[model samples]
Target: MTVPAFSLRNAVRASAPLAGALLLVGCVTGSDIEGLHRHVGDVEKRVDALAKQSSSKEEVAKLNENLGKQVATLLRSNADLGAKFDELTRELQTLAGKLEDANRRLAQLSQQLAETQARLAAAAPPDAAALPTSEATPGTAPPVAPAPAVASAPPRGGAPSPADLYAQATADYQRGQFELAREGFEDYVERYGRTDLSDDAQYWAGESLLAQKKPREAIAAFEKLFKTWPESDKAPAAHLKKGVAHLDLGEKAQAIVQLQFVVHEYPSSDEAKSARQRLKALGSDSR
Candidate 1:
């Protein structure tokens, strides 16, 4: 592997032209070098895309399927929510219907209680015999006396109990003694004005006046009751009777005003029902 000094010198001299020619041929411009780099980069990008093409398509397909499943789940949830909403609506409607029916039944029971308390104040068998039983006897004649009220009068120089006085007053009214009934009820209203039955006594006084065919006096009595005891449960009945008294006197305008008042102020009362009937008969039903 060692060469003589003269042979090495000769070999270097002979390769000088070849080295110069090689340098001259490799002298490229900057633009030509950049173009070669761009070509290499483009080739590398094309190869990478071709190698991943099938995998990229498969990944996109999987993504689309996952999205479809999510959409279907959302649709099912919406359907379930809609069904629940419909069920709640139906349940509320049923509850409202039941509440309305219960209200109607309660109104009827209260009306019956307000109209009938004769059995509570009956003093003896004779008084009891004068009233109808729980069920009506269809063939019985129309009542010759009061429909269902009577009590023996209290007898003493001292003042009687409130109950006995009230019972006796009602008894007088029922027994066709209108003047005596009016006097007794007026006395009760004057003395027992703060008692629970005071308003009722005043109302009966008006009824007594009406029974005697004194429509003007009955209206005055009703007006007194209204001013004195506006909160009485008997207010509606009083209004109805006042309206009827007006009707009996051929005062159609006055009757309409009173009847319409009942329909408006006591819509749930039995008197309201009667008022509505009367209004219909007078060709002025308020509906």
Candidate 2:
């Protein structure tokens, strides 16, 4: 804009000098006046061209400003999308935990029922199979007395089933009885390690230990889960907990390693989001 305006001013100045020259030379001819008019027309055309070029430059700048705003808006939208994804990940983890507990309970009940039926069937058949088909004669070998029936049902008092044990341990954890919950969960995993809830039990045991301020023990518990149940659904959470345990013990380097593992290994998991947050807090790379 400034360059065009400067050219226009200089053109006006030059035209003034020409008009003065025309006035000074009273003998100027019609042809000379015509030539001067043509010169003025050319100057006018040049000014118009420069003005148009300046306008085009302004329009280009406006377009660039709009593009920058759009880019900033897109970046904000992407951040919002990432936050929503983290929320969904947390919700999915919660639902999966609930489903796992339900399955464990149902499976445990079915197994206990089948075992009871098998025991009763085995106890009753032995008596019949031992009896002789014909009546016993005096000289005949005396019929062997039937062995005592093995009890199928528990006595009036008995320990709870695996399902009940797990439920009680979860209840204790919910009630803030971390020590008791830790013991119960460890016991379940030790005795019923093949059960569906074993991995879940082990994970909760680590949680219990962490809650009790025993971060060292909690790290061990979480490590046990990783070694014994590497394919468990709770592996991501276990990694996250282990990282937190390290933090509690002021083991910054180890904590960062564990947190980064979760972020890289389970990027779509809720635990990964938590791990990233922790990594960011520690001034480490989350990726």
Candidate 3:
């Protein structure tokens, strides 16, 4: 019985340490569960932050896309406006040019009318007594001497002088006897080339030829006037008529040269104005 009691005491001592180890293990398990809960909460918070960042990036992309579209639309609108402005500018330029041309034509007409009135005022009244004697039938004019002769002394009275011959030729020209007038004027120029009215007679001879559609003869007469009386008051008129005669002969380059000469040499004269008009018609831009 003493040996049995001693075995029981040893067993009790071992059981006491085993009970303490079990209690410590239970406390450690509870602390581990609390740490697991904290880790799960941190992971959830991180996922929420990532979701918000993704949504913000999507919103920013949409806003940027809308802004790009608006900028493209504005650029297209500006380009269209620029094209319309350019078209309007061209139309305005065309209209302005047409208006300028109309104004120039109006001015030319006024000048022509004024010149006609001045000429009528300067001309002398017609004499009925002189008209019947000077009026010759068409194609039935009296013959003038082929070569001019020295004027004979009047029959004890003052006969018509060289000046009277010029006046009679002018009358024939006014009556549209261009052939007879041309011959008479040529005779006057040949015989009285140094007289005061010689240049006038020569110029009228050219006019007579031009009226009869004789461009070559007209050109020759005008050239003679230019060479013989370069300082005459009719020089500019001769140049102008010579240019017209060249045009009649279908000599465009020669016409331009003669017209240009008139314009350059007599810029302030009526002949120059006519030359400018002719040049404009011929597509020359000479001022």
Q: Write candidate 3's Cα lDDT for 101-121 as tens digits.
A: 999999999999788656534
| Candidate 2 Cα lDDT to native | 0.76
Error of 2 at 57 (Å): 99
Tens-place lDDT per residue, model 2, 92-143, is 9999999999999999999997885555334321222332334331111211
Q: In candidate 3, how many Å is residue 86 off?
A: 58
Weakest lDDT window of 10 consecutive positions for candidate 1: 137-146
- Local distance difference test scores for all models: 0.73, 0.76, 0.73
TM-score, prediction 2 = 0.46
Q: Candidate 2 — worst ten consecutive residues by lDDT sum?
A: 137-146
Candidate with top lDDT is 2
The all-Cα superposition gives candidate 2 an RMSD in Å to the true structure of: 27.0
What 10-residue stretch in candidate 3 is worst by lDDT?
Answer: 137-146
